[model samples]
Target: MTPSAEILAFMGRLGHDFARPEFLVRALTHGSIASATRPDNQRLEFLGDRVLGLVMAEALFHADTQASEGQLAPRYNALVKGETCAALARQIGLGEVLKLGRSEMLSGGRRKEALLADGMEAVIAAVYLDAGFETARRVVLNLWRDRLDTIEDDPRDPKTALQEWAQANGMKPPAYEQTGRGGPDHAPVFHITVRLDNGETAAAQGSGTKRSIEQAAARTLLERLEGRE
Candidate 1:
């Protein structure tokens, strides 16, 4: 079911109000759905990307007075990045509202991280356009406030960090290979493998917006290696 009024009311408690219900509808629409039958979400996705930037900027500035652009940039990226957005989407049960084409639905597109992330971004943008900046910022912070509070500096992508760890150990650099991917064009998976030069291989699975699956794959490999020792 499209997110019902109760669901929206619950979302409102998170600080999001839809001035344009149509935009909200578009944000939840996937391209796979027939254009005539379902409102396409791509446009809102585009707008949402920008809205996310503004909202995040406001959030960083509003929440922390000491943060400079350098520090704020990474934090903002972590919050608004595709993987982060997907995680937030799932937390709010956004997946339950998406409308997909028969093919996409059959392919389990409703639960895709990519789709959810994009839709969430679109939704953020839509909210900004419908209402104003402060409201949108509130919406973002309400959903992501906890994550923001728990923020840490990862410094490097997990793959890069993993490779550095392997190389310093006199171990050959780790190799990564894609195993599989599935989901809508906007959101796809890259199942990956991380291997050490020692002929040891480890596998892991994760879902997200960017190469998050790779991060999971790398973390998995690291844990398995640690476990073996």
Candidate 2:
């Protein structure tokens, strides 16, 4: 069968004319719907993850001549994390093309961060296989252009920073608790609280996921303590 118009349009946005379009189809296939004839994107996701890491590592190494390994590590993590990949997938309308089973579709799998991130990585691997490493690198670098340009010098996650602070002060790491949840199952809001060993606490809400909500709470707590938020 020929590629659908929507898939072709997605390719236009992706900026690669696939030599083997089957790869793109496989890349968009989710595990929830996989079958003997139609394999899922899991393997592609794994390859794409490594591909993304290598490209980002090389880019960071060249982008900042003065940055130490410690400084570059956080920046690399910030760029290549699943959340960021999912955001990029959304930007390119990847979720719209994801093939999922009925259950996953009902559960809003298309909009899931993990699924989107995995799909993004799979697509990267598809590009690599369709053409070559340089082509994949080009796509990754182009897709990550804005993020690469704007990444902070020290881009550690707030949760990681908070834990470091706690450990340095002879305190246990902060604890995160889900205080409440609201909204529909497809799009839920989570309330999380992060409490330090000293009993200092911060609470925040996020519309993404439990992990994101917890991170938001940690960020809020860290900002408050440091007078940055």
TM-score of each: 0.74, 0.97
Candidate 2 RMSD to the real structure: 1.4
lDDT for each of the candidates? 0.74, 0.93
lDDT value for model 1? 0.74
Query: Per-residue lDDT for 1-229 in model 1, tens only?
Result: 3567855864564466565576677777788874776768888888888877786677677787987777777777777777788888888877877778889877667677788888788778778778887777778777877887787755345676678879888987788778777765545555777788888776655445336766887877776766777
On residues 1-229, what C-alpha lDDT tens digit does candidate 2 reach at each position? 4889999999998989897899999999998999999999999999999999999999999999999998999999999999999999999999999999999999889899999999999999999999999999999999999999999988899999999988988999899998899988988888889999899999988689788888888888888888943
Q: Which stretches of candidate 2 lie over 4 Å from their true place?
A: none
User: Where does the lowest 10-residue lDDT sum fall in candidate 1?
Assistant: 202-211
